[model samples]
Target chain A: MSTTLTPKSSPIDSPDLRAWKSASGGGDTSQPPGLLSGAFLQETLAMTRRLFIQLQRRPSTLVAGVIQPLIWLFLFGALFQNVPQGLFGESSNYGQFLAAGIIVFTAFGGALNAGLPVMFDREFGFLNRFLVAPLASRYSIVVASAIFIAALSIVQTAAVITLSAFLGAGWPDPLGLALVVLILLTLVLGVTALSLGLTFALPGHIELIAVIFVTNLPLLFASTALVPLDFMPGWLQVVASLNPLTYAIEPIRYLYLHPDWSLGSVVLQSPWGSISLGVCLAVLIGFCAIALLAIQPLLRRRIA
Target chain B: MPPAVLIEKLKKSYGSVEAVKDVSLTIQPGEIFGLLGPNGAGKTTTIRCLCTLASPDSGNIEINGTSVVDDPKVARQSLGYIAQEVALDPVLTGRELLQLQADIYHIPRKVSRDRIPQMIDLLELTDWADKKTGTYSGGLKKRLDLALGLLHQPEVLVLDEPTVGLDIETRSAVWQFLRQLKAAGTTVLITSHYLEEVDALADRVAIIDNGVVIAAGTPNELKDRIGGDRITLRIREFTPDDEARSAQEMLARLPFVQEVIINSAQGNSLNLVVEPQSDALLSVQQSLKEAGLSTFGISQSRPSLDDVYLAATGRTLMDAELAAVGTRNLKKERKEAMKGT
Candidate 1:
């Protein structure tokens, strides 16, 4: 048998040796490894590896994730192909105008669904595997999911950006590309945090799916994904202005239209005020911070 | 020295139903301890509390003398728990799953590389280790679960119904593995409703019923405490009550016989509790012949653990199991299982 077997002789000759050997063997030792300890990093990496392995084996989620956004890009671009130039912003073509929205929305949608797998884990009792481990921090679970979802969002955004270029939605300059990645990352972090929060808060997968179902399409419609904020009614304009998705979308849209875009560039002209690029990025950062802060108690209750 | 595991006055409830109430147990180091109980008798709940998966409403759970409620991470590190239901992610291969487990336990890269193969070999899972667990048979899945549980080599290995749905061969293999584990000086705590599973494996047993430990001792100690050799005498196949009563009456007069009950449930078989003596079996047969009631079949043996349970709980384990079926709230139980500490 490959399994290591200890001899019948007792391993514990002294208290200190017993404690050291027990802890090294992953035996139940009495003290918690200190907070932010190496054990936390090991557990988080291991959990994140499991997610990656699942994604690799079941590649459908990845395939569909990329495919869904591309379909949105092609169909929505065709729908507005005949519209007059400059109607939706400074872009000469509608496809160019839609690229930024699709990039932001694709990452947003992917990040929003990040909690589904976690919710399923909870329902299926897989989370208990982690809960029972002597993890340094239970936040490792949340961190792993966030990291995996962020990586997936980055990949999907890259694909959407490449495909948009093929459809003649002009590419952003080198710095513009960097800004675009930053924006998608910020949006993903916040949305991923919210999704993970839902995973811990929701009772089961059915309830989570229902919540995702309602949030997915409505957020797209209300944001500047399919339509510019200037085109919406007075009430929807206010709603869109408040939507975090709009903040992510408008800055990317501004980047696509102006290669010389800086933080001072006006991204959206709301009824209340003109939102600057720096303000948009700050809103996204703030949204992520709040989303993370909001889920703390939920994670603590479940993990502690 | 502290026991390998100690649970004291552990209480937990789901809404109105108390799943576990005042459960106290102390399992010494390196012994195979069995928690025997009918369904809904709080065996799983007790295990859950010890494993740090669920917090007790009020109790102290210690793993190797460290408090579970106060230092759950340390308690968790000390124990390896295999739940009743296997929870492998179908998408990941068995090797990947074990790797994940090794990581969660913070097994070093070198140790994990060495240990994973050893576990696969120990469980006879080398052939199936690379396949997704979703495709594994029940036995194979269980073997993999056992591997995962043992990967960390925890001092106290806690399993809940380890072989509940396994085939006879698989169950035997698991029993053998547990014995091997015990030989290696690892403390094992297992819960099972199967009478023979406990009787055949446990070094010591605690019989729990209705959220409490009704009896606890070595199996022989409990059986011996009940006291008396049990003789089941069938006067004839499908013996009539009058004949059984007459035989029972005749048996009652014997000086060595302590008690007599006519079991009409089993064809009026006269159950006799007699003092252990050299001629006890022969005297019962001789008395039946004298009464002119032909002996159909008769067997005499020491009192079993069931008799001990019956003596303490006023009902057989089978009867308790049947009664528990109606009252078991499976949905409520599942929700409770999902509730983390």
Candidate 2:
């Protein structure tokens, strides 16, 4: 808590002078300061603040992130607008049914790109700046990125929810809206973890970008994001149900359509078995835990 | 008292290429030590080990009495490293970047608020403090990096090629700043391929070649050990080989002249190393004039650090750098650098 502004003196004028006289000389040289909880928290918050400031100054990424999904919502809904009533099931129109899928997909897509900046940091050698510092914990790098991505996901989710209501897909009940937020948070956390892991493991940003390009769209189509599992062939249904995005989408969809639902209510009927709402939540949590655990070795090698 | 930095028998190999075979050095407190080598001669590798950024295969690196291998976190706190390449987040202002650096070192908020501006003033960065680093010129960025490295008041500051590519004015400014840091009782370690840079800055120097320390001493000590005055003589601007050989033979007979060789690369000029205090230049000119050969140009000087390098390695630093460029695996080297602690 002691703060002193020692006047800057040229070393030539006072050859024997020691800068930081109190901290650098004499007492208590045995201990390092970065290990304390307060110190670690201060570092993590500062790093996270830098990311937010960047986002604020460069608003294009956020604007494009929100706008791209809305564009998809309008285009995709109009494409299926003429389909026979009730054919897509339960909703008044295609736009109503399609809004849930687009919300989940948009959040999932944005989270998948979280590693691009980290990968760029690695290539540009900015990561070395962090490595040399006496940081309390290297996990702060991961924590900072997670916080940035989560905030972006929330803003995008709100945009889609508001737009969906305008497009005649009535608002979900308060409890249902809360469930949507929980589902988005869990999915974003897991995906962000995986993306950050790839950033460290891949040799360069080009390779990481290639992997993102290959993985993004295929995972979306294979899941129940755009179409229900029942609409696909039997084998395709099995694949769709196995995809993690489906687990996230189906619960939110069930929440929007069935406000009186309980945890015991079956949310998804997969080829393997019927999954209740509780089991879906458990699956998403487990997916996140596994993703976090999977990146441990990679992070250790780069951060330790 | 413990040395400010100690590195012994350090070795690091990338795949089949042995980058650093064996290197050992000790830097005294408050002294400026220079690690001199060609581009790929392991200077960077040795510094990397000392900073705890890379682990050596088999060696000891201690900073301020703390073993970097055994307790890197403590050693890291004692040292501030400025990498050769300046890496800055384009979006952050110079001041914001320093704040991030303060956080990483765990400098208390109160201390950071007071110390940050002092560092900015010390480095003469006030005019550019509020501008985003992306718009900064190369010299400005390097200065900002120095400020960040010194913000914690580290006991030892390590810089890898501090002025590799800078305008003359900026380079001199950096040199002046480093000397000030040393005067304040901060030990400084610098690595450079430029012979004059090391000559001008280091209190002691270790000359490395092919991943090994071939010679180590103060500049004067090394020059004195090689003990001789050198004279370069050219009969004509581009002398014939026979004439150069005859001149070499004639100069070899003089009692004060120790050795002579025809340097074919420089127009077949004759290079001579003579005993100190010997009027070797006048004798060579007189001998050449008697032989009906006109003196094109002649010069005499004491042995330099380059002469010491030439004596130990049998190759000039420029030649070594050219050879290294041909053999270097740039991609592999970058990947190796990226491999963390």
Candidate 3:
């Protein structure tokens, strides 16, 4: 009896109120047509736009993504500045041999951190907004993150290529440059897909960040990113040869050394055998395909 | 023409914990329906299943006669959900967030262009519409959430604890807006543990406890089914133990009084359940006076929803809420909620 009744009167009576009533009435509340095609595109674009807006407002990530590699190119390149010219494999300067490794590693690092944003979204419950909405496909959420990371990788690749050029690592011919971009794109797409898979599979941001921390530096050290495979002991050589990053690095390095290199040009001399530039590209494609396919079950289970 | 929302025998469990054992509800068009329960009583789990955010282990759910499991996309198009927690992009401006919502819901550009401003004005968000949502207060964020939920104007608008943390003024504003929405023929399904909130807004309510629907009906119907009026009499503010016991014994023997309890929590107040009558208040006062006990306060009123909850659950809603708080594993629940299926 002490409870006051809910008020029955409107606090704001305006013509705009009628608009809300009519808007609900104006459209049929049925599923949209072409849900798989048009609606998927719309939802993915909207989600991607949100990430870009965040990047635009907070450019620190982009600045760091570019700047971090430049520092590596400078300091690490300087550490080996006195190494004999041909010791890095037929390159007159260590900077030239180091450029391909740095470019591919930078892209790999950028793509590897792709899961952090999605994990943060999960932690903050912002991802719930996407889950509850009638998204055409939940994979649009994954697709958006992939798109954003790919764009960032491209920008970082361009910046690394330019900085290396200034350090006396001459730019490749137009075709070789195009091949370098292709190699970076393939590597980034694979790693980004794998990162996103971890986002959905992990419990929270802390777990995801922990995984990234353990995976990031070890993969760099184990691959041919910092040193040529021949510099490693026999056991380490096997691990390096098996690493997909090695496949990505060797092809780009070959393109840097041979401006007119063909797909059949030999890029890596492995314990297994000689690996050609074309085989390296093919290996990267296979890695991407397998990474993408491996996450299908996780995505279906998580996002449905 | 079909029921705006229908959920039948819905059951969902997370690992060993059964969040929703068996729950069912039917909501009509143009009326506000409430799912009342304590925390961890599976209210959110029920809402999530209906929204297609989580799949039920076994059940049938429909939105406007569309089978949710069979065609969730169509069902989702007919439903708009306002979650218990406000999940806004802190970095995005209010307008930008609304734009993102509109795009995801597939509201056409031409339609949303006018609709967005209309919502901004209707929700009284015109001033803060361009600012980052992180800068807004709790009330402002809730208002923007409401606007986002209402932007597409689905036939069924589901709100989960819409006023849980709102101020008095904001709460009343939301109540008023819901009334207008009902007047304009939108079906609303809401959940809350607040007895008065459900009492005030719900046309029909289902009281859930321990993952089951223990009672369901109009608020008045459930209260009337209890078939009694509650009277609280404070004999002397701090009545002596003997005097309070005597009053309880005397009140228990009265033909009109069906039950009596000494509420030690309220300074030994005697609470009575009596048959509804015109002079129940006066009769109780006279009975107390004849026994030589001074009446500090006395009042009689119709049975409230709390009484109905107590009648079914054998515990007051507050006590049940406290119990739930002690037992709930909020961290695990959040993790389960994030899973899609």
CA shift of B243, model 2, Å = 5.4
How well is each residue in A1-304 modelled by candidate 3, as lDDT tens digits? 1122224334345434555677544233454445367778878899999999999989999998889988999999999999976678877788888888888888888889888988887788787787667777777877787788878888987888899889988888899988887887788878988998898888777888899999888888899887888889999999999999999998888877787799999989999999999999999999998998898777655331
Docking class of 3: acceptable
The per-prediction tally of clashing pairs is 4, 0, 0
Residue A51, candidate 2: C-alpha displacement in angstroms = 1.8
Show pairs that collide, candidate 1.
A2-B118, A27-B78, A28-B77, A28-B78
Computed on alpha carbons, the lDDT of every model, listed in order, comes to 0.83, 0.83, 0.85
lDDT tens readout by residue for model 1, B276-331: 89889999999888878798999999898888888998888889989988777798
Docking class of 2: acceptable
The full ranking of all candidates by DockQ, starting with the best, is 3, 1, 2
Q: Is the docking of candidate 1 incorrect, acceptable, medium or high quality?
A: acceptable
Q: What are the DockQ scores of the candidates, in order?
A: 0.38, 0.33, 0.40
* Model 1 alpha-carbon drift over 4 Å, by segment: A1-24, A27-37, A302-304, B237-242, B262-268, B339-341
lDDT of 2 by residue, B1-341 (tens): 99999888999876567789999999999999999989999898888788776778898889988898888778878889999999999999999999999888888787788788877866667788899999988888998999888888888999999999987767877887787777777899999999999999999999998899999999999999989988888889999988888888888999999989788889998888999875667878898889888999999988888889999999888888888886888887887566443
All candidates in order of lDDT, best leading: 3, 2, 1
On DockQ, who's better, 1 or 3? Answer: 3
In model 2, which regions exceed 4 Å deviation? A1-36, A302-304, B233-245, B262-270, B281-299, B339-341
